[model samples]
Target: MNITVKFFSSLMEYLPRSVEGNAMAVQVDPGTSPRQILARYRVPDEEVRTVMRNGVFLPEEDRDQPLEEGDVLTVWPSIQGG
Candidate 1:
């Protein structure tokens, strides 16, 4: 199956160099979870402050859920403002 993964803010550094932008199309086996992708990219759990799937916020508990084909998994790093 294929899905799109997007990293925002500082998390964008984790994206593959081949990826032109913050998003990349990736191939995954069936039942692949967002957590798996994060781990694959070496994205630290503490760095991930938000996770969205297809524009909807994905709760931490639900991140283990299997991702369907064409799903968009977006991640954002922790942000700080003065």
Candidate 2:
């Protein structure tokens, strides 16, 4: 299945060079989970502060849920401002 993975803020640096923009196309198994995609980019759990599937917020626990074809996974890191 094909999925679109998007990185925001500091997380954008993690995207592969082939991904010219903030979003990239990836191919995964039928049962691929959000966590697996994070792993693919070597994004640490702590660095993944927010996750969304097709604009729907995905709670941490639900990240393991299987992602469907054409799904768009957006992730961001924790932002701090003083």
Candidate 3:
């Protein structure tokens, strides 16, 4: 299966340098979870503040759910601004 992963804000640094922009397309076996994808990319769990699958918010518990083909998993880090 194939899916698109997007990292936002400071979290974008976690993505590979070859990845253009903030998103990358990846191939994974069936039942691959968002958590596993983050781990594969060495994205620290603490750095992720939000997870969205195809524009729907995914709660922490649901992050481990299997991602379907063509799903877009977007993550964002905690942002601070005055």
User: What TM-score does model 2 achieve against the real structure?
Assistant: 0.92
Which candidate model has the greater lDDT, 1 or 3?
A: 1
Ranking by lDDT: 1, 3, 2
lDDT of each: 0.94, 0.93, 0.94
lDDT of 3 by residue, 1-82 (tens): 9999999989989989999999999999999999999999999888898999999989999988999999999999975679
Candidate 1 pairs with clashing backbones: none
- Model 2, span 1-79: residue lDDT tens: 9999999999988999778879988899999999999999998888899899999989988999999999999999985
Q: Against the true structure, what is every candidate's RMSD?
A: 1.8, 2.0, 1.7
| lDDT accuracy of residue 66 in candidate 2 | 98
Better of 2 and 3 by TM-score: 3
- Highest-scoring model, lDDT: 1
Q: Given candidate 3, what's the lDDT at residue 82?
A: 100
Cα TM-score of candidate 3: 0.93
Tens digit per residue, CA lDDT, model 1, 3-62: 999999899899888889899999999999999999999999999998999999999999
The TM-scores of all predictions, comma-separated, are 0.93, 0.92, 0.93
Poorest 10 consecutive residues of model 1 by lDDT? Answer: 72-81
Task: Show the lowest summed lDDT stretch of 10 residues, model 2.
Answer: 12-21
